[model samples]
Target: MPVLVKDYTWSETDTEVLITVPLKGVKPSKADIFSSEDYVKINYTPYLFEVFLYAPVVEEESSIRVGNGVVEMRLCKKEKVIWGQLESNIKMDKEEMRRKREDVVKAVQEKMEQEQMERATKKREAEKLAIKQQMQLEEEAHSKIEKEKQDERDKAMEELEEWKQHKQEETKTTSITNKPTIQPAQLKQQQNSKLSHNMWQDNKDIPDSQRPAPRSGGKITVNFTPRYFPTAARESTEKEEQEWLAKMAAARKIQAGTPSEINKNNPMLLKDKACGFFKAGDYEAAINAFSQAISLNPMLPVLYSNRAACYLKLNDNEKCIQDATRALELLYPVVPSNHIQRAKVFVRRGTAYANIGNHGLALQDYEAAEKLDPDNTQLQTDIVQIRNLISCDS
Candidate 1:
């Protein structure tokens, strides 16, 4: 059951009443508030606050401000007279409260639906605009390609005309008798070049200058960006955003000092830091902290024992067993002062063994812990459980 909030403060003027509800550890964005002419409510998960107004107020004019671990509300009173109380003294039973809750919930859900519709409409408009721009860009690219082809054809025609004129002039100036004796390899190269020129020139139906050009040989590889979206690279923040996220992940990683600097700080402090991390449910960070503590002082049995608990939480059964055994070894010659810790070490090791399907070894370790702490009911329970497991296996 949620505890009722009765300790809230209120002040009233002739035409306004201000109420402040202290809600510790509550964020403003997460708190849900509903206000009507005669009702005011604030729901912050486990905590719920509601009040029936002593006098009717203008709900639309009223305002609520949440900040600094408190929710402040100002109600605009309809009447000019000062009210005796901020809320009605009459207490509401469960049925009345339930109806009020349902009413406010319906209103909130309706408001949320309207907001979702607005967002969807905006998204559709944006998508349509993007599609139109992309289509326009594709059309422009098609026209540009056609223009480039025309320009290349004109350039080829000019080059072919210049070549024909040069060949005619060379023929008129030279004679076969004046030609030098050519090597067989050179004569064959000239014959191949003449055959290639004639092949394009042999198209008599089309004008010589207008003949189709043969493309140069060799592969031309073109690479395009691998993207799921059609957005241009210059318009996207994907690369920068990814780099920022990578940096944030790196910053959150656990970092331990080098072995040479492990002894610089107090072992107790390092152990405390490890315990804090373990309590916060960061098992990986706790393990790193525990290792640093162990490197500073390996003789401390408690350090190894605590690190074992972290390993157990992470489900590293073999490492848990190793740490627990190391702790037990360091806690030699069981005495009155260390009996509790010794039993704890035995329990941890036994639990690790039980996890790894070694019921026989688990039973042995539990029995040892029972001898150290005879009154430990939990330890006795574990002993019984191991015995039952061993019996079932046999």
Candidate 2:
């Protein structure tokens, strides 16, 4: 059942109607607005609002705006007349209203998908046209240079024929000082023309710095911050866990840990099996076991944190970062109860980030963990190392 929203305001002009609905604690992205020429609806979780308009509106020209915790619709009236009421008195039963909303929603969704496809098609066509123009420009530049060379070749051939004729005529004369010969200055001018033509073509191809750069994208990395346990989260248990984790920071300690008490409903047995593989140095098997445990109990943050240790041992920093980050997210809200676990995950993820040359992000995680376990000298050292790495990069 939806809570019908009664708090809405509306005003009308001769040609348009402006309707505004204020939704407390609701963002525009979270609100789903559906509309047709005769109907409008707003669905934001428990809050729901819908209306069957008294008169028809031009749905194509109607516009919606959302800002500052309110959704406003400027509906273009089909007839230039003010309506007595916003909604029609004709009431709809639950099933009828459901059918109407469903039909309208389907139509709206189909239109959105069609528009997206059209936009994508247009984008691809534009890219093809742009590349084609670049190719034509380059080809024209090459053709011009070739034509310049051919004209120079014809001029040189004519000059050679004239020289041959002159030499033939001068064969019978001892004094040949007045013969028409190609001058050095003429040769230099021809050379300059060819050089300038070639240079122009060379300049037609833009330098790398002047041209637009290729589009690029960066990797998305998630980092979670642990809560600062000022009063010692979980007291003695938290202290002991933090100390143990600090000792095993390098992940070299392989322990034959005790198994959890067996219960038919308990999933710890699966986790214990993964830990056993981890202890025996069968990291791949441990990872598979951990994955199985995660599939069974994905809400357990410990499973991801444990699997992250195995990934780190295998020198797979990327996987380590992913698992560690997931573990921290599972331990969200950063309360005192989860402070210890969250800190451990933060340290593990920080180490993974450091391994992958993301010292700045690693430092961020380390600093968050430090607030939770201020007495841990190892955490302080890790933080210092990350800071040093960051400074070196700068």
Specify the highest-lDDT model's number.
1
Report the Cα lDDT for residue 176, model 1: 54
**Top TM-score hit:** 2
* Model 2 lDDT tens row, 1-394: 9999998999999899999998888756557676788888887777998898888899889999998899999999999997968987554567777777677655654565455456656876998998798778777767776776777667655654565466557566745576456578766665555443342234444322222222233233332233324444445355544544443332222222243533122334556666655654457877987787666557677889999999987779999999998887666555566677888989888888887898888899999998988889989987877788888999
Q: Taking the candidates one at a time, how many backbone clashes does each contain? A: 0, 0
Worst 10 residues of 2 by lDDT: 207-216
Give the distance in Å from residue 356's predicted Cα in candidate 1 to where it truly belongs: 23
Q: How accurate locally is residue 273 in candidate 1, as Cα lDDT from 0 to 100? A: 58
What TM-score, over all chains together, does every model reach? 0.39, 0.44
Off by over 4 Å in 1: 11-18, 24-39, 44-47, 52-69, 73-101, 165-394
